[model samples]
Target: MRLITYRHDGRIGTGILQNDQVRPFVGEPAMTQVIEQGIGEVADQGIPLADIQLLAPLRPTSIRDFVAFEEHVEGVRRSIDGATGVPEAWYDAPAFYFTNPHAIYGPDDDVPFPAASVARDFELEVAAIAGPDRTIFGYTIFNDWSARDLQSREMTINLGPAKGKDFASSLGPWIVTADELSPYEKDGFLDLWCSASVNGTEVGRDLLSNMGWTFEAMLAHAARDSVVRPGDVLGSGTVGNGGCLAELWGRNGRQAPPPLTDGDVVTLTVEGIGSLTNRIISGPEHGPAVPARRRDPARARHERQH
Candidate 1:
């Protein structure tokens, strides 16, 4: 079953989507509640999908995005510094980063263009939403928007993709329940075909089976010393074969494609999960910039001596 959160008649509620119509749950329970207690009852009649505005299926409690595709890693590294092969450490374990959860957007929503960036890009990925007891509740399309210039600068210091990545992330058309996608599962990885496009032009496509790490392994890595709470989202980072512009740049010897601009529409489709589309709009005005202080050499030496 597909689950969605939508706005109808000026009211927001969670519902079951079927045949392009929505059957709203009895009391408009929160999606987290729906994840915990199964959808019990729904209205007899359904509302036309076009009449209501769809919201993000759920606001994730936390988001952990992992680089599970080796080709993606090699390609991105090549783009950054002309490096050729995947790092040896990458083979040891799943690597991931926490992204902002508050900046989530739904299908058809307008994503703000980051004011500080000119090299905006999108990553085509799939996200698994957690259910109780560390199990997966469902899956959805995830567009991990990126500010390439900012990311390149920050990573030069070996630290972050924080401000670079925290700007926005798009999730959903709706959630496809785990069972619905079970038939596609093979050896802990799904055999789904994933594709991405921008403004009617195809950019990339690859199979989810290309991922080197399993969701179970990623979850185990994530929960090593913490909890995998319900509503937590874990992203299967970009698939291989041109999943993002950076990877394409690497493949093309650093010749870059036009970055995402205002009014551009990005669409990502995963065979069983459905499509997620969003438009880019101008970002909010920039705040005052912060400057870094110069290091004091004498103080540094004295501290070292002490």
Candidate 2:
């Protein structure tokens, strides 16, 4: 079943997505609540899916992004240093980051491209939202927006991607449950295809079958001692030759990074999960960052020790 987190009449809730209708799951707080409580009985009694304000499907405890696409990695590595091969460490284990859940946006929303972003681009990826508490429930489509020029410049300092990636990351209209898409495992392939359109013009497109590291492997590598709780998310890095700006405006292209202008509407579509349409509103004025409270220091310290 496709699960969704949404708000109706200013109240937020979770439900199952069936056809074009959203079946509401009463007594469930959010997707996070359901994941912590486990599935089965609650899912069986979900409400009908209809018109609802689809929020980010879950309140992720963490967002772990992995370098699952070798070509994308190789492409970046080569561009940076003329390196011919990927680093041994990059291949040894899965690498990820703890992203702000508050940074997440929903389908049909507007993305504020900060003025600091001179080169804005979109990355087509498959994002997995953990559902079974510490388990990878299933995969969904993701768009990792990037500021190519900013990222490239920061690499020289070797502290990388903080401001470059912290601004925005997009996820679904729904978090597809594993049982709904099990074929994604057996054949080690998914027919899911991805595409991006800016103001009705197609910019990025690729097949999900192109990933170098499978979802299972990425999960195993990410879960190695770290507990990926329900509502958490994992992104499958960009696909091959699918660099939004690297291939278009980086050294690979004839110009500098292609900067998105005001009023540009960028729509990302994945075959099964549906489309995420976001308009480019004037930065800051569009909306403030959803203020996330600072992490609790005592809890933070305990978590670190574990």
Q: What is the per-residue lDDT of model 2 for residues 1-306, given as tens digits with 9 covering 90 to 100?
A: 787888877888777776666667767566777766765343454444444688877767678777666677776666544566677887767666655567888887787766756667777777877666356686677777776666777667876576667788888877877776665543676657778777887866777777766777777777777666666788888765544545443336344445676677777777766787776654653343466688789999999999
CA lDDT of each prediction against the hidden true structure: 0.90, 0.69
Candidate 2: the clashing residue pairs are 21-49, 22-48, 22-49, 22-50, 23-47, 23-48, 23-49, 24-47, 24-48
**Decoy 1 TM-score against native:** 0.94
Residue 172 in model 1: lDDT: 95
Deviation in Å, model 1, residue 121 alpha carbon: 0.3
Stretches of candidate 2 exceeding 4 Å from the true structure: 40-50, 77-85, 184-186, 285-306
Span of ten consecutive residues with least summed lDDT in model 1: 250-259
Write down the TM-score of every candidate: 0.94, 0.81
